[model samples]
Target: MNGPDILASLRANLAQQVQHYISPIPAPLDVSPWLAMALLQKAIRRGHHPFALQAAATLLQLSPDKLWRRAVSIAFEDIGIADLEIVSLVTASLAGKAFRAKIGGEWLVASYLVERMCLAPKCRSADDLLMLSERHPAYEHLRLGLTYGTIPELLALVRSNAPLPKRALALWYAVGSDRCPSPQLRTRKGAPQTVFDDLCEAGHPHTLVEVAREGFRRSGQVLCPFVVLLASQKSEQPAFIEDDDFPPETMCGSLPSWALDVYSREGQQALRRFLGRNCDTARWVRSHVPPVQRIKFLGDILFAVEGGLLRNHYRWPLADELRRSWAIECQGPFCPDAGEIMSMLRIDIQLLNEERQHV
Candidate 1:
C-alpha cells in the first residue's frame, strides 16, 4: 500500500458523516489468562485501542471479573498523572452492567474503554515505583500498604519512611491523591480533583487553552485574545461581568505564534480579520446561549483535536483550521522558528534519501 495515497484517501473521506474505517474485533485465543491479559496490556500501552478493546472484550468473555480487575490495576499502575481521569472511568466501566448486557451494551463498554485509553497520555512512573516497592527493603512498608491499604494509608506509611526516597514518595502522592470513583475501593478524602474540575474552577473552559496559557507563562509568550475568549465563556459564578454578557473588546489580544515571521504585514491583517469574524461569532454564541450550552460550541474543537478523534470524524474547514492552530500552539510556548524547522526538514530528507539509496 502506498503511504501518501492512503493518507490522501483518508483525508478525502474525513468529511463524510459515516465511518469508512472499521477495525476488526479480535477473536479469542486459547491462551492462559495471564498471557492474554499481557498481550492486551501491550496493545493499550502502544495506543492500539482498536486491538486492545477487541482483545479486552475477548478476555472479558472468558472472565468478566478478572478482566475488570486487571483494567483497574492497569489504570493506577500504567496510566498515572498523564491522565488522571482514566482510573475513575475504568472503575465506572467495571461496575457498569453495560459490558455484560445485550443489545449493543458490550460494544458501548468496549468503545468507551478503548477511546479513553487511546486518547490518554501514557506514563509508567507509578508502575515502576510499585515494582520497586515489592523488593526494596526500605519500601517493604510501602509495598504492604499498597497491597492491603488505601492510597492515603499507603501515603501515611511512606510519610513515616520519608528519608527512604523523596522522588518515589512524590510520585506516590501525585498519583495516589487522585480521586478514585470506584465504589469497590475505600475512598480517600482531600484528593486532587480531575483536570476538568481544576480548569473549571480556574475559569478556563478549554483544557488546551489552560495548557497553552501555562506554557506561555513559563516561556514568556503572548496569548491571542481570540484564543482566550475561545478558551473562556461567560462564567457561571462571575464577579465582574454578568453571567450572560461577553466583553468583545477585552478579549482581542496577541496569540502565541511561531509562524509570525512568515505572516508579516498583510498576512497579519488577514489573520486578524479572520480572528475578528470568529470573535464576533463567539460573542453571538455567548449572548444567545446559556453558559452550559456555550462551552461545547467554544471548546469542543480543541478537545476533539487533542484526542485525535475529531479529525477522524469531522472534516469541517473550520475544524481543520483549529486543528492546524492546535498543532502549532500545542507544541507549548516556544515553537521552533523557521530556521530550526528547516534544519529538521533537511535531516528528515537526508534520512529518507539514505533509506532510498539502501533500498
Candidate 2:
C-alpha cells in the first residue's frame, strides 16, 4: 500500500469536530509502533495535536504500555521547566490502569493529558544537556574525574556554586552512573532517591523534586535530574522565546515529513539508498565505520542533523548553549570523523529528503 488517503481523510476530518487532536493525519494507520511513537512526540513538539492524538490512540490499541511510557518521557523531556503543573499532571497520569480507571477511564484520561502536553510550551534543554554531558569533548575530564568522587563529595559539589556542566557530572555520580539511559555510562553504585532527596534538602522545591522523582522512577531517564537542575540555576535569568527554523518538509504520498522519522520503514529504506551515494558523508562513513555498524552510525548522524528536534524550538540562553553543544558533540559518538560527517550530512541529506517525495 502506498498510503491510505481517501478513507483516512474522511475519518480524520470527521474527528475534528468533536475533539481537536482527535483528528489524525490523512494517511494509513498500518504504522509500526516505533513510527507511531515517534509521530506522537514530534507532533506534540510541533504542536500538531491531531497527529499526536492519532499516534497516542494507535499506541493505546497496539501497545498500551508504550503509550504510557512515551507520554511520561515526553512530559519530562519536552515540556521541562516551561510548565511544572503540566509535568505533574502527565506524571500522575502514569500511575497505572487502576488510577486511570478511577480518574475517568483510560482513553478519556490519556487523551486529555496527551492534548494538554501537545498544547504546552516545550523546553528541551534538559535532554540537550544530557547529550553534552555524555559526549562533549569539553566534559571528558569532568566525566572521568567525577566518576571517582565519593557520594558525599559529589553531593556537596552538586549544591556548590559550580558551573552547570560540573553540577551535571556531580549529579550523575551522586545518583549512580548505572542509570545509563543511552547505554553510555556504566557500573557505579548509587540510589536515584538519594540524588532527589539531596536536591530537595539543598533548597530546591519539594514539589519539583517530587515531579522529577516520579518521572525518574517511571522513565529511568537521567534527564529527569537535568530538568530540575537546569531550572534551579540561580546564576542568571534566561529569557525564553519561540523559534521556528522551518526546515525542509513535505509530504511523501500522504504521510507528512513528521511521520518519516529515522525509525519508520520508509525512512530506513531511504537511508540505505543514501548510503550508496558518493557524497562526503556516505564516503566517510563507508571507509571509517565498521561494516557491521555503518547503518547504525550513519542513522545516528542523520538523526542529529535532520528532524531530531522541533522545526520550532523553545529558545533560551542556557538551552541554546546546550543545543549548540549537542550539535557539535553528539553525532554518533566514538567516531573521530563525526564532525566532518555531520557537516556533509547537513547538505547531502536535503537531496535525500527531496528524493523522498517521489519514492
Candidate 3:
C-alpha cells in the first residue's frame, strides 16, 4: 500500500487491536501516537526516512511539552490502572528526545498495548503524575490525591469523584503513578495511618484536608494536598484496594486457592508415584548426570517454583552455593566435559515448567 493508505490500514488495525485488548474510552484514534507511529513505521519500512520525519511532525503537531502531556493523558486514560512503566518511559522518551528511531516511538506505543493485554506490570510512575499536573490543572488534583494517599484511599477517591476528567485524574494519580512509601515500610507492624488508609476511612470531605496535611508530615512527600482535594470532592465509600503484595497466585485468576490446594495435594501424590514407579530410572539418571549438571538441575528446579522467584528466596543462598561450586568444578580435570549437554538439560527443564503451567 502507498504511505497514506498503509498508514490508514495500520491505524485501523491498531485501533481494533487496542479496543479489543483494552476497550479504551472515546475510541483509539483520538490519541494519535499509535497512528502517528504506524505512519512513521510504514515510511521507514519503505526506506523513506525523510518522509517519515515529516509525517511524524505533521501528525503530532505538538510542542514537546504538549506532546508529552498528551502522551501521559493517553497512557492513563487508555492504559488506565494497569502498568505505568510504559507511560512513564514514553513520556520521558518524548520529553528528552531520546526515542529518535523511525519506528522507536511506535514500538513503544505498541509495547504498552501488548503489555497491558498480557496483564504484566505497567511501570507508570510519579513522574507522570508531576508531568500531568504541570500541563493540566484538572489532573493536578487527582495527582495530588494519589501522591499523598495510600493505595486504598486512592481507590476510594477515584470511585466517587465526578466529572470524567476528575475520575480520569484519579486513575491517573492512583494507578498510573508508582510512588510508594518504600518497599521496606510495607512489612512494618501496626495499622499505620497512611494517606491511602486515611482516605479509605475518612467519614467527611473536611476530614481529608486535615488528613492530607498529616500525611505530608508522615510521608514527607508533596502529593498530599491533591489527595486531600479529591477526598473533599467525593462522599461515598469505594471498593477495597487490591493489596499490592498479595501473592501472584491470588491474582492469576485461573488458579483458585481451592484448586491450588487440590493441585498441591495431587502434585505431592504425583511426585511420590513417579518416584516409586521410576526409582531405578531416577537413580540411574542421577548417577549418570555429572555433579555440575546435577547442581545446575537443582538450581533450575528451585527457580521453577513461584516462591523461589522472590529476591530473598533465591539470591543469597543459591547464588553463593553456585559460585563456590563453580570454582571447584572448573578446576577439576574430570568434570564431565558435557557443557552442551548440561545447557540442553537446563533448557529442557524450563520448557517442561512452561508446559506444565500451560496445562
Task: Write model 1 residue lDDT over 1-359, tens digit each, in one string.
Answer: 23234333332332231133243464565544554465455456546665566557667678766566666555544443345445435534443454334213454555555656655654443333332332234444543344345444433543343532332432233233223222222223332223223333445434333332332222221111122222232132222211111111111112111111111342233223322332443344445546544433222222222212211121223223333443333322223112333233223322222222221
Q: TM-score, each model? A: 0.35, 0.83, 0.20
What TM-score does prediction 3 earn? 0.20
Alpha carbon lDDT of residue 197, candidate 3? 49
Question: What lDDT score goes with residue 173 in model 2?
Answer: 72
Cα deviation in Å at residue 124, candidate 2? 0.9
How many residue pairs of model 3 clash at the backbone?
A: 14
Model 2 C-alpha lDDT per residue in residues 5-117, reported as the tens digit of each score: 32233223323322443423333256778878888888888878777888888888889899999998898888888777678777766667875665455677677777778
lDDT of 2 at 227: 84
Which pairs clash in model 1?
Answer: 223-254, 224-254, 224-255, 225-253
Off by over 4 Å in 1: 1-26, 98-104, 137-359
Ranking by lDDT: 2, 1, 3
